[model samples]
Target chain A: MIVSQKPIEIVNILTHSNRIKTFYLKLKDRIRVAPGQFMMVWIPDAEEIPISISYFNGSTMGLTIAAVGETTRQIHKLKIHDSLYVRGPYGNGFKIPRGINKIWIIGGGYGIAPLLLLAKKASSMNVKVISFLGARNKDELLFYDQFKLLGEVFASTDDGSEGFHGDVTTLVEKYLSVSKTDLMYACGPEDMIVKLIKLACNHNLNLQASLERLIKCGIGLCGSCCLDPLGLRVCRDGPVFPLKILVKLNELGCYYRSPSGVKVKLSD
Target chain B: MSINVSLGALSLRNPTILASGILGTTASSLIRVYKSGAGAVVSKSISINPNEGYKTPVLIDLGYGYINSMGLPNPGLDEMIVEFKVVKSKKVKLFGSIFASDIDEFKYLASKLTDYVDALELNLSCPTKMGVGLEIGKIPWMVEETTREVYKKSKVPVIVKLPPLVTLIDELTLAAEDGGASAVTLTNTAKAMKIDVFSKKPILQGVYGGLSGKALKPLSLACVFKAYEVLSIPIIGCGGIYSWEDAVEYILAGAKAIQIGSAIVSEGLGIFKKICIGIKKYLEENNIDKINDLVGLAHRR
Candidate 1:
């Protein structure tokens, strides 16, 4: 267990809704975390939750959180200069996979957090990165300015209140049709990842997904975090995996049996 | 100054080992954790065949703790053998944790892995996703049968990992002893769930999950105390040990050693060294000469 005694100062707070807020963290001790990786933000008495790192410079780390429950809602209470305990840059982050020149990053809701980091890193490397983001309307779409600095960005929403008045996946597909991207990275809803995997397969494009699996101990012990079939742990082996591996195993490549040791279906 | 605990023939440098299921799937990750100062590390649960465990949204943060139903996702025994072999070569006190859909598979997995590592951490506890998870730990007969088979086949010592949910600690502990377990690990993650208020849905693909982290420590400590009352075998205590104070509490509560989990995510690999130093300072200040003196002190009081 690595203890981060240094208190991370809240430099900025970007609110997405009544529930969600993005904390701009200035670390007491600077550490570099890759895109698609996450930080565990400790809110006093509220419990620590893993939020994906949306953006990072040398001294600061950005955490975009949806104020859904106690932890997130409590996190929303933080004012500028308020301090919290944080650790990580944990888990397997999205690798800029080799042999890819141009890449498309598709994100929805809070999923835009990690994708924004990916886009920024790609832009730094001059990887021709393009980001397609969506949310319920305009309010839910986060990191608008940061993502814009990364690449050519496309936006969408469920209601006609935002850029592309349709699903974010529609924007992703539209972009893929217009411009050729060698590789794609996606994170958001499970349905969205599944749908994107299907689209990539149908179109014969390379795809990688940062899956959202139930995890207890992020380091991979609790057995609570096992994925269904591919016999891989989302905590250890992934939060990010290539679509090629996802196509094989059951329940999105987890080996989950019920408490009775009975193999149950994902729906069950 | 930190306490040292034994799993069997192997002597750990410290009592705090990374509990089974924390970053043990790959050789690289295991090595990274070992270097972090855990006396030992347990591999993730591997089954008989290739298993893709669950779908996406497997993890969610709840008010109390985390709810995850990842299931027991892993490549089969054959693939795990390769991974375990690499782990063993690292010369750390590596342990293998395995789960099966049935008794026969558990026996088979134990037989294959027994020769490769210092010990076998049998996972009889897992909540949420399903399959031979919490059921085995919850039932004495199932624990006895599977542990018996594994103990008989293994060259190394066997440790049965139990969930904290068990209502009968004495019965389960005795069952493990009858099956020839060298030791028993108390308190796996607790079953839990998180709901998305916006979507009107369960946060995880599997819906329910196991809760770990600081929220689970008290219940886990109570379980350890209860199991220590009847079972003479060494018990490995786990569930939300983050600091030296937490580790010392487990010792006082009667755990031979403790395992650290969720803290690593929030803290990082540096936690191992920090805890070691903190424990040393505590011992030095308290004038305790040996780690054993701290064990079960609360029970004595």
Candidate 2:
């Protein structure tokens, strides 16, 4: 039997924004998961895409995906009980550092998916948590009430359509100014990751952030998800990495690849 | 129960080897695949200098198979020596794959890797530049000349890898044989593409890329079949092999050994041991004492 490929039935789907939806799947086996871990979702003939675990509970889990690309577009059409091939909980996920009682979680856009899981996990462990969730507008902010159940939420919208008028990073910077934390975590567009990396580095705070790259084989064999020069495979070495590894890559915020493998500056 | 197989000077305890371009970049990765139960592992095709490859969506999947245009990304030969040395120390069965846009580059790269690997697998199966005329590794004379040049400096067995985009698989196989190739790996990823109806354009950033996985299985098998008919040297079957059954099929189709790429990504590192266990069981059931007995068994009338 193929252990990696499991046929899971969709129990339900939670629509957040027009583009983002969370799929709750019922699996035969108990899926042990952690924040920042990603899964490779497969539909028989449509396409295969990598998704981060938005939430996990015993034999069931949720995947928060945006219907932006081809594979994700197909996933948005999936109905309940529809069997899709699911594999993993792959890659190195975020780990709570020792002696860290207070934590800050920051994210923007679809990047909010994994951070939501981190917030829930930290609060369940009785750790104090603060989250800064952002999007293009108030309508795009995700996991509003759920995040509130876990910790304080600072909602930011790029268009000033909600709480904060500027970017999420500004909210995070402002929060850190008012109150400091033992550790910080972030995920978002490359530019945001770059900005957060600098913020964490400057403050001398330990940071772990989940990154998204062109993932072909989530198990690390594909050689598609690489940060060149160091040859780090994002799928295996990380979807989540410590601040040190990101700093080592050197190209962190400066350059990233487009879907076609062309190098593009993060500023672009 | 011994699944050891030989193709010229190279020896593998099991017939399953990691194909080029699949987790073959670093020394740690090669060791990881070796520890996972691969009889041997091949490095991704390295060239004269480092390449950034195509773009972000360099690879994509369509359930049964994948289409990727990695554009042969590497840190070039100079930067790989340290990693190669570390890999050599692990003593994992390793074959190094080298590529070039011209004849001189082929000889130079092969010469540099002489001491780092057990053998050299020359990748002449690219789209353009320095093949017979149009297709690379397709023309018989081009194959012979390229193989001979690399074989000159390569101390170990020199194996030529061919793409399925050729007119005559046998002729190219024979050409490698004539040029003193130790073995030939049949078929690299076949060129393919997918279109996004929503975007009204190609799904891949690059309009065309190579197709692998179950989609290229038949093509690889046919190349091995035809190459076996014409050449006496060992032929390593690659492309789309996912399980032990796929491995056995390649052997039956006259492949001396087989390489697996896309399957490992789908099946995980466990695939190596899974394929090995399945082959041992198949051999035990068939009462076959040696793996070579099954190699090219289907060639009999």
Candidate 3:
């Protein structure tokens, strides 16, 4: 069946930080969405962008967005009761294997949005939840209090104003040395995720990461979000991928295609 | 049943071609589609210079189809050539689709891509306000001139993809034939738009875009059927082909081959193989020995 965008009104709005805000929308129909699967949020006539589902009940879903581009800036202007056209709950989401007692959730900047939902779900399943969240400063750390309520929460900031004085990956590395976890779930900047991949490898932990790309069509038809070598459509094959597949993607953390299909190198 | 069909100098194992602009930007994507059982694959429309394209809401699923105004985004000829080199090494039937506003630009793009591709498809019909797509395609003389110039400069076969909803299918087809086009792709996406009633604004960032999917099938088939009556060049039917029956209908309507586009959104790469299987089953059931024998069958009566 063909999937079309449904215009949903923003029921509530929450300001998370200076750059980030969460828009809670009520869907007309119930949608079964996983933690990392995203929605193509359209701010009519402005642009459409993929925002991961940060919160979902039966008919209500929340999209936590950072005002980084022009379209996102438009989304930030939206108030409660405003309509945003949305399609999907697209792409694959994070999968928690059975019999796993504990898992580490690593997130950085606004990436913590999707991981918060994961923490909530995992906590409900009686799985021990340890979250490591980082941002540029204490003010930027996302969902710290929410994560604390679920289980253990480690907050990091680049300027040393938060719980840990370094990057979240460094904090993860320090923790991995002292303790053990069944799996590691991450959603963050490419550099942070790449570092986490290495740590996961050394610690022999399976890692599942929600990656980002320049997505035009949330459906698989557009090659805008395709990864190199494997030619996997990031929109279809994954926004969330396992450690086994992530290790083979040469483009991961190296470069991402621009809107014009140019390979722009990821900034170090 | 022998499903192989030949379009001038280009031969396909089957008539199911991966339509341009659907996962055709990267070399890896082309290879992936090729391996998924498409007879050939067309690259996304490339241009002389890099284009950032329009901002999103560039595309929307209309339930029956999609309306998109991607604005011909590409990494310029230089980067595409690098991508083509990798695809060439894999030995897949590759068609380089290029779009330009003028004859000189078309000639330049065709010359640059001819070496790496099996054929060059002139994208004269993308529905954008960029003064290139339907703007150039609508003018019959411009179509003739661009096709003639590119065909002259290029060593491989040249295919002209025409815009849909034009006044005269015969004029466009004859113009391409007179300009030495080896084949013609009968119809690109129809110019269309959608609006958000709540916002009181057009859904696409570009205000207008091209429509593709199940809704476009009959329109495209009509174009192919009309073009078949007047043109000598092979007709490559494109627009809204989703299933095997759709492929058969296009073939009977006089299309030597068919292109699969928007359906890939729902069917994935496997659509190629699925449609091919369906066509073969159709031919076998109908007692047709070859797929070529079915072309223009609808006009036989």
Candidate 4:
């Protein structure tokens, strides 16, 4: 289908850190979105960035912003009630299994956003939730209370100022070790997912993962979001892929050059 | 309402084409483009044999452009014929773009796919590889000899895709016309690369990639304008055409049609229809009728 730009109104802006903010946008028309889907957010003349929908309630879309570059900083500068251009609900979302009794969800850094939304969705299905979220410090820790209200929440900060003295991945690993679950969902740094994927596979838990690639178009045109080995376009096949497929991604950690022919490792 | 931009005997319902690369990788993608409303779609440049192309991280995104060193990844002529046979949708015309390391490979693949496609695009100016670099295009005799060989054996109309380099472009176009080229598509992305300061390394595996998007529009326009001045054939201008204004620049500069690649990456597939609509609005506002009326209009000054 032709991608149409939709104008969404920002209902609220929750500042998560000095570098990151979360925008709760309510569209003029109802927006249909699934967990793990992303929207191309427009920033007038600067640039358009692909941001995963962190949380959405009815007509509202929540975007957790990390001001990693110029475009996102511009996005951060937006005020509540400001008009923002958006296109999509693009890419395949996390596949919700039927008859699940309990589910485990994990998030790290800004990746915690989408899984938080998924957790809220799972709650309505009557699935018991265990969430482990982590950031570098207490200030960078996001959405702790929102997730805590939904279910049992575990928060970790690297600087030892929070619940745990280590990383979120460690906390999720500990939870997974003790919990009986039907499925596991995770979003975070590649290393975290790699560790979680191995853990999920070892425990024989059903696992789904949301991977972030250098995205140019939210659609499949640019070929920038290709995962290694399978060469699957994240914009088309998925931003959320089953751990079964994600585990086989060979270029997941290989250092490579950007499109400008500059050499940079995929993970720094 | 529809507009037809003539490419020899073939007529495109709109001026927007998928351009080489992008979604032109396979017949299924080409079919998808036709379904998406592109008046025409050029197949990815194919070769006589299978090519694995550059390693992972072959494509990168610049703010207003893209650089890719895909190395003409293709499934060979034999595999491409199977793809050609399945294009049943008559509404969107198919154009097969082919490249080769040498003359024999070009002729062989051209003759093989000619019967299956309406037109053949000779890809002599890919920015990724130096083996098939500007050497052939920089010389008049090389262009004449290669085009002559392919044109002699192929039954379909031939379009010589040119690089953005100004040097010897007229000579190359003249040579292609001499060898019986039906039209020309100008211009391919210029070769470029990026570097990372922390890692101290080149960005692409090949150290160079084809640059496309708004960064190359002015250079591409110059190539089309120059080629149009010398060649009495249809010209398909492509390079950083992100808006209708860019497409109009191509037409007024002397392009009969235009192709879009990198913009689709940032804008999505809807860009084609959007550009066509914008072009229509501009034309209507300017009291222009057929798009042909504006071709070469810029040269008057």
Candidate 5:
């Protein structure tokens, strides 16, 4: 089997901010992928984790990763020429809205990685995209310049270092007061996505939001990433789901399982 | 009303085989599966040593199926065999699925497990590992060598759980048969991966893992259908046999028996009888005398 996995060379690395870095990766061949799709990266014996695509322009892909956990901490230690094993741009991706010329995008923290690509895809399709970007501080804000190239941006940093002086949700509340859009797409913290889902549901607007969960086999076999009560396995049925399906989930930010199968509170 | 069907050298009371990598790691779990109506239960793929496996997120419940990167977590074969011999009743037909890195390890495990279980399923198809599992099963020569070494030493029926990622599924089956394998578990999980866009991180700690569930049905059914066309030996159809119709589809496509893996978790333990009853109902409606007659019926056209 000329398997799905291969050792990819780190061709380039760009520091997006102090905490977040983007790696330019190239495998043996072009890994065709959709904007919201993701890759499973392996660092040999250390640990493997999934990373969403920030940019894929045929030849190479960019992963805007933050040094958040132990695996990502190790990932940040790599230099140019270091090899990283990768398989897939797996899981379902976002569905581009048809005939809609206007879209509103919302994201929090590192969740902006996948939305960056989606913004590019949407804008390139002649859609008027207005992105709402949020982070803890000015230094924490990511892809502001890259996003500026595609569409309009309303940014928020907690310290008021950028566009809006407060929370991203407040920015959305202000925007929704005056105008409405064809679709609202979001990716971010559970609380943020949960809030976005409620916002989208109340407006009766079409929404596609990505969700994250603990997953064992990235494929649909292990039950670790299953959402409670609704029982939706995040790996296959989604990394992305429509508002109608997502709104039905009872566990949408209320709880999640830990790495070893403990039910932990997801209030954060 | 005998539902027995010959799976190469072994004949199961019915065609419902509990696919490996479920709850078969423990003796009680194996007994539970048997009691629930599985014709046979395959153990979790055991190595010579215990594996802690990957951290949390070993399994995810997909609306239709599930994803797992469990890393073959199991107690060592020696320990598992001891528990089976001590606690598990010997009356239930048990198949041991063993994972080893090389030919010698495969041979040794097969030899040790021979008298304890009725059959040995060489787990050559686990998708998550590196040097072994699917890596070993991918090479036709390794498939032959491992099967030959284990077959020479094994007293019971030796079946190879072939990886679906292989270039030619039939080649692996033919090679195993050439190496004296009694049968081939037509396929195992597909190599797949996923990431959490929310965290901008991967879902599984191991990154890459296997894909099973309702999605795998067509691929596995095709494998059994193709293998049946080329082989004299019996085919054990696995991968996504969730319902009775799925099992019967495998039967019509040419599987002597079918193995259920993810469905055990998604549908529940009672799924075994559900499938059996559904199959029985089909047999009655069609006026089929033996369940074996349903096997490979699709080839008649």
Candidate 6:
């Protein structure tokens, strides 16, 4: 329920792609963050935006951001030692299922950031991780080598410049035909996640995914990120949801609210 | 155990209301609040066009309460109507709050929302640099004129939400009543500010924001008490109401209904049901049959 932002100094910055950079901040206090939880990051003189906790070693936290919007673009210009204000490792993060030995990790584009953290956590729990990473091309594939260090890595590029020749879902389908996985985890574009949900449902496999929305106030007070029909606030109720809840969200991949709370049709 | 109260033509199953701008942006949110047991809900103040509002740090938790300057961001009228249609279909008691810089815009907003909402709440007390909120509300003549103009066009009851200006509470309440308002929401947030010492800048993007929480209860209670002595219209007390004790105090001070805002942040949506249970028990213990019997009862002694 705390709304005040505490200043955290950026200790290091790593460029992952032309549009993505991973910034590590030194924490003044210990923040217990699960793999899928996010933080509201504020850049001085710019806007505050929600970013997933891509890496956390108890003392230093990493936020892998895509320079897609004004706030993130401003965040990209900052160097090491510049301070950024942050509040929360908020929302319910991904929960590792008990007694599971093997799991499939699927990520698309910049969505690969959070999955890497989940993979790391799973690896530590003695679970086998099989990751499927996808992007427009090999150049956009985020954390390929990092994800590889955890377990088996399957890469996909839309241009056929990587392991698979088509979208990540097509690669997942091909793998699913010959192999059986106990569970699946994902964080990516809504359309890709929607496709994964269908795949999981058809295969009778359980899937957990981290979602994205136009968030304001990053707390439940403002209803900017509330999902329709269910009235679940993406900020508090979840940024990560399971297949059961994901299927009920009628607005998924079809529409999204603009910053002003206007419901606009999602472009195909 | 009966807690139903009537505010003119409008009847609430209970007296607990969701104050404007807390969680009122979308239809799902309004319906969610209704499902959470709120007697009624007021929307975040909307304008004719989209407002992006202030940037990051628009709100902060001061431990005692909250200070926020959201700058009245909304998706404008047409988009809000789409959300209102869903809320109306579910039969939720919705009060559409609108803010404008002038009479013509207020009239237009009222006409558009009258069909969708149970009532219209004129938001004249949002603390911001925007010329619409306190700038117009601090003027007694403007309050009267704005209320009168909107009331004329509104088919549903009109509730004017005023600021908690200590010396002006009496005049503002009287102006609202004089201008044909069916009810007056005792107060909006008090204007306040906070600064970050290291950064040497205001915490909120808007230099000044409205303060709401436990800290505001006394000021708002005083405003309600003062207004009740002068105006015949029902007073809906808002600000810093977190518990049933706070709700009872407002009733004693002559508020017909109470709006819960900052408390929802700390206590969650369950506060509505909890408050009602407390009030029902208090009434039963006091040998009262209906909550309406407690309205302005403190003034008797």
**Per-prediction TM-score, please?**
0.60, 0.69, 0.96, 0.63, 0.60, 0.95
Q: State the weakest 10-residue window (summed lDDT) of model 6 chain B.
A: B128-137
Q: Ranking under TM-score, best-scoring first? A: 3, 6, 2, 4, 1, 5
Q: Candidate 6: give the clashing pairs.
A: none
Q: For residues B86-139, could you state the per-residue lDDT of candidate 6 as single tens digits?
A: 999999999999999889999999999999999999998888646644577888
lDDT of 1 by residue, B54-109 (tens): 65344554434555566766666877787678777878788788887687888888
Give the C-alpha miss distance for residue B192 in model 1, angstroms.
Answer: 1.7
Cα misplacement distance, residue B224 of candidate 2 (Å): 0.9
> Model 4: which docking level applies?
incorrect
Give the alpha carbon lDDT tens digit for every residue of B139-174 in model 3: 789889888999899999999999875458889889
iRMSD per model?
10.2, 6.9, 1.1, 10.3, 9.0, 1.4
lDDT of 2 by residue, A88-172 (tens): 7788888897677999889889898888888888887888999888899876788888888888889999899889998999888
Cα deviation at B268, candidate 4, in Å, is 1.4
Query: On a 0 to 100 scale, what is the lDDT of residue A105 in model 4?
Result: 83
Cα RMSD for candidate 1?
11.3
Q: A170 in model 1: Cα distance from truth in Å?
A: 30
In candidate 3, the residue pairs with backbone N, CA or C atoms under 3 Å apart (3 or more residues apart, or in different chains) clash, namely A47-B56, A47-B57, A48-B56, A48-B57
Q: All predictions: root-mean-square deviation over Cα? A: 11.3, 7.7, 1.8, 11.2, 11.1, 2.0
Docking outcome class, model 3: medium
lDDT of 5 by residue, A1-268 (tens): 1123356789999987777999998756756788788876666445667788888888788887889888788889989898776666777888886789899888888888899889988988999999999998776677888888888898998888888988887899789989998998888888888888888878778899899986555654444466644446677667898898898877777877654343457764
Deviation (Å) of A36 in candidate 4: 3.4
Chain A TM value for model 2: 0.94
Fnat of each prediction, in sequence:
0.09, 0.22, 0.84, 0.10, 0.10, 0.63
Model 1 docking category? incorrect
Task: List DockQ for all candidates.
Answer: 0.08, 0.17, 0.79, 0.08, 0.06, 0.62
True-vs-predicted CA distance for residue B200, candidate 2, Å: 3.4
| Backbone Cα, N, C clashes tallied per candidate | 56, 10, 4, 13, 27, 0
TM-score of chain A of 4: 0.92
